[model samples]
Target chain A: MRRADRTLGVARGLGWFSIGLGVVELLAPRALARGLGLRGQEGLIAGYGAREIATGIGILASRDPTPWIWGRVAGDALDLGTLATGLGRRRGGAGVALAAVAGVTLLDVLCARALSSRRERQPVRSFADRRGMPKTPGQMRGAASDFEVPKDFRIPEALRPWTSAA
Target chain B: MRALVWHGKQDIRCDNVPDPRIEQPRDAIIKVTSCAICGSDLHLYDNFMPGMKNGDIMGHETMGIVEEVGPDCRGLKKGDRVVIPFTIICGDCDQCKRGNFSVCERSNRNKDMADKVFGHTTAGLFGYTHLTGGYPGGQAEYLRVPFADKTHIKVPQSLTDEQVLFLSDIFPTGWQAAVQCDIQPEDTVAIWGCGPVGQMAIRSAILLGARQVIAIDCVPERLSMAAAGGATTINFETESTVERLNELTKGKGPEKCIDCVGLEAHATATLDSIYDRAKQAVMLETDRPHVLREMMYVCRPAGVLSIPGVYGGLVDKIPFGMAMNKGLTFRMGQTHVNRWSDDLLRRIEQGQIDPSFVITHRIGLEQGPEMYKTFRDKLDSCIKVVIRP
Candidate 1:
């Protein structure tokens, strides 16, 4: 597979992963907060969950997922920052969560970088010369003037330019 | 015979199938020389239009040499070169007699189902949904043409298949779309989607002497092609389509608008498009009428909205009140290919336009499945794909 296509596949996989993780975080925010030792920050976790779901939908729905991948990278940074706050309360659990977030963050950054580079590396092909006519477009105008518009297809007489009152 | 068969959504396979025979007295079999993947076929490939069953043969734009003829087929004989119209028509039907061949009454074998779905049975189409006819399409090495006496357009041997093949669909479709607008010398015609049909519409508008032809699309190559064909191109991604169209027309809006972008309007960019995507995701809507909405909004009052684009099933959020109040004349239907084929063929013979310029990819029948994906994804700048089956 081409590098861009491969990265796109990875991005889609990450998108589904984001949605799945967001669902769990949304439905069980309190449990997630307790596991990370950030017991009082359930609402914040839920907000982040909503953000993840939005980003995921954006990634899957947009024609070019590059911007949404960059959005994911941004969201990952926020996730890592939030995870860092719980380190003082439960060093072991928070450390594990921070490591997981850091791993996913690395993926997001790599995907964003790869997509950007590939987009820049490609050249836009021009079909400007493919006029599909023997003569210039100006010369070809009204070339089929010999043909008559069928009576049924003609606009109503009242709507014709000379027939209508200005 | 090798042919492209639809197994399911996004699953077209080049498989060995039994060759077609003359199944009826009017049936004629043709050894297909050139068949093209049409924009409407993408609706089938994506499983957007319903009535496709597993193992259905897929293709519509086809032309070939007659190999066998049934007893009742008087106009066509063996060795005759012919281009099959996508719409199967019985020449004696009331609709056909009125030149509305696309809605021919007797051609579709599955008429009851189509009557239920469409209120009245339209013409049977090759390799389209069962709702149209469930007829086997011409994407194979051989095609059995029912009602062959009246369903074929005999082409001069001097013209190549690429020049005349599109007479079956897009060429006539675009021509009809322009003709339906009744374009005048003072009219400005705006066409949406620069796919093959859109390209044809652009050339047709210019030939019909529209004062200005503006083509709207996001694809760069397609935009470039549209410009080459004498349209001022709009990349909807970079510019506000409504604003640019208004500016071009000095805020009067174009007198004629053509929608070549149909059910699967690109789901990014605009808010309504995004909403369409959301509704479509949950099965609440079946079509994205973004172009329909935009055309109604921007067309000159009492102007014509000619839709050569195919829309299947229901669409939401159409501004019907605006269209009704503005006195906009909405003209939309499957192309009556026979209605415009003779004139278009003469234009081709006279070098008025070469439809072959739209062809970006050529492949054998074996590559049909991969080409479907490539065409669907708009990969490799594919505007049209013609298979030399």
Candidate 2:
């Protein structure tokens, strides 16, 4: 597979994953906060969920997903910072979540890098010499003027020029 | 015989299939020498056009030498070199007599189903949907051509396959698009897409003596090719197509607009395009008519909008009122290949234009499945792919 296509496939998978995870975080932010021992931060968690959903939609909808994947990488950093604060209160769930987020962050960074490199690798190709005409376009202009337009295909007679000057 | 067969969406396989046979008196079988992948075939590859069944052979642009002829086939014999037009036609039909071969009344074997879907049956097209006759196509080692007496264009041995191959479809399709415009000496023709048909339309407009030919496309290589064929190119990604066209025509808009980008109109370029994608994903709409909308909005009053692009099923948000008020003449249909093939063949023989310049990739029939994806994705700067079976 081409690098661009491979990376794009990965990006699409990640986009679906984001939407799924965001739905869980959004509808049950209070339960998620309690499990992570960050009970008071439920509102902040829900806001982050909305950001994830928006980024997911951008990645899925846009022709180029590079910018959206970079947005995902930035969101991962914010997620890691939030998880770090919960480490003091709960060691088990918060530690596990932090490790998982870090793994996903690595993937986001790699996908973003690969997508960027693919764009940079494509050089603009020129076909200036592939002019199918026997002569210059200017010289070839009106070359078929001798061929008559079929009667059925001709424009209305009223639309035709009445005189050379007109 | 190995032929490219459609199993499902995005699933084309080179499978060993039964060789075709003559079922009718007028049928002739040809040993296919060369064939091509057309832009319309992409509609089938993406599974957009309906009525396609599994195991249908896939291809349209084809040419070869006659290997066998049925008893009633008087115009063809063994060893005759011929290019098979994509549209199957019966010369005795009223539409055929009027030179509207694309809408021939009798060629489509599945006319009842087509009548329900399209009001009236169009021509039976090779390798297209079953609604157009479900006839087997020419992407294999041998093909069975029905109504072969009137359905083939004989070419002289002096011209190579590359020079006359497109007389079956794109060359005449593009020619008909420009002819629909009825271009005048002072008119400017603006073509959309810059794919093979767009390239041909550019050259056609220039040869017919249009004052200016402008090609709008986002692909750099395609734009460069259009420029090489005597057009002022517009890269739609970096500039506004409407604004550029208006400026080129002194704010009156081009007198002629041709839509070569049909259902798939670069689905993320503008807000309307994105809306089209979203709707298409949910099955709320069937075609993306972004180019249609743009042409309607920007064409000069009393101008012509000639469409060689193919569109299937429902389209949403067309500005019919705007077009109606503008007095724009709309001309669009499948190309009547036989109607214009003789003239195009003469042009090829006279060195007026070389249709072979559009081909970017050539491969054997077994490689057709992979090339389909490459062409669809615009990978490796592919503009056209020709297959030697």
Candidate 3:
């Protein structure tokens, strides 16, 4: 059976959202590092890109989104801590990057809450229920159970006037 | 019914074959409306995948309207449109119950042959070699679907045949490839071969949150298609994939790599690929796994490598030491289509993906012979072929 569309949709959205930011950081590490007032820490910015991408894939690849979304919360905390460190450093656009990071933190918190609560509402379905068919295996016999080659179905002999080996 | 029959290597013909009827209690006969020629079929076309006899009907990816059913068939009725998964399942075995339907114990009639080769038998596959199961494929006017209730999925009327057809194989195959990689948002994935499976892997990686997807191939059309699917393309003829990938990822190498090109991978100046090709031609090697070796060498330390490509027999000189030293996590298998079909179908319905983007040709079943050559030779920009039987 399929997961609730809203849950998967949100998870996929957040996954792409993380990758979008990750690309910017990976491609323009110096620019992002400077904007966040973490100049000379371009390598650190790229490291965060790697972490963000990983979190996104974790969320997309699994049915349960709570743990990965929670990891995003922790990442938010790290971003804030770094931004806090950058507040006293000499840099440009630090305030802007901090406000942007704070906004994303809010989004991460909201997603984590939604995923955690939905986990309670949506219970896993049993195999029979998920199969979505009318009859169970017990109610039916396999086609080849009492094996006998069909009389009319001839095995081709691969020569002129193909003949049945059976 | 008229069916495409494999006579021998590079020789397929549309021949008059006996109409498929309900042979067993749970069987159903389907009038095939749409079917596809898969990349794996090319292996059989080239005589790479073995155990093919002269009269084996060829095809597996199929969707059709149910025309008849046997006494025990319960879930489907006449006139129902259904998509048949390539692998047949009994749904009662330990493997099937655990959702490992592709390796189910009870399905394969020729289990002894498979067991002898692989040390254990695998699931029975349609239109695949006798090693899997000698069940006739779907590239014909009519097909007999065994285990009808569990093996075929009913499709809603709202979706077109093209949109849902791939639920049979490649979509699930590619999806499993991406899922097994254990992708993190920080991961960069590089996929070899821009074929259908590779293209699907590109889309799967993007959906699964890969940061940068580097696609490697020599085909211009396939490379362009991969780029269109949001990947950086690398033409193996023009660029060194390993070096270019390292350069693209800032000397760290991609964290994940996928080998979508299986046994018959191509090579250029790479010493290993050239050697593999020479050995393969001389019968010393069963497969040319150029991409497998490259993936191991280019993957970052502790990276994950996923293989969706089909490898029939044993591989030689796989560089196990490099994979071990690099701490690479390896995942490869025949797709568990029964497990992932529903989810991928839902994804299609929701407009998250349209699998038909990979289809480059659509012809009647009679064209099977020529299309086989065209597909294998990569002519007419062929990536995937859909047959209207």
Candidate with top TM-score is: 1
lDDT for position B184 in model 2: 84
TM-score, candidate 1, chain B alone: 0.99
- Model 3's CAPRI class is incorrect
List candidate 1 stretches off by more than 4 Å.
A1-5, A37-43, A90-92, A121-123, A157-166
- How does the DockQ of candidate 3 come out? 0.01
Would you list the C-alpha lDDT of every candidate in the order shown?
0.91, 0.91, 0.80
Best by DockQ: 1
Going through the candidates in order, the fraction of native interface contacts each one reproduces equals 0.69, 0.70, 0.00
Q: Per-residue CA lDDT of candidate 3, range B1-389, in tens? A: 99999999889999999999898888999999999999999899988887999999999899999999999989889999999999999888999998888898888889999999878999999998999978999999999998897888888999999989998998888877877765555668899888888888877777766667889988777877777777788998888787899999999888788999998876334567656655665578778788888899998887778899989776799899999998777878888888878777877786667788788899998889999987886767788999998
What TM value does model 3 have?
Answer: 0.70
Per-residue lDDT tens digits for candidate 1, residues B163-204, read: 999998999999999999988888889999999999999999
Off by over 4 Å in 3: A1-166, B267-269
**Residue by residue across B201-289, what tens digits does model 2's lDDT show?**
99999999999999999999999999999999999989999999999998989988999989888877888987887788779999999
lDDT of 1: 0.91
Q: How many collisions per candidate?
A: 0, 0, 8
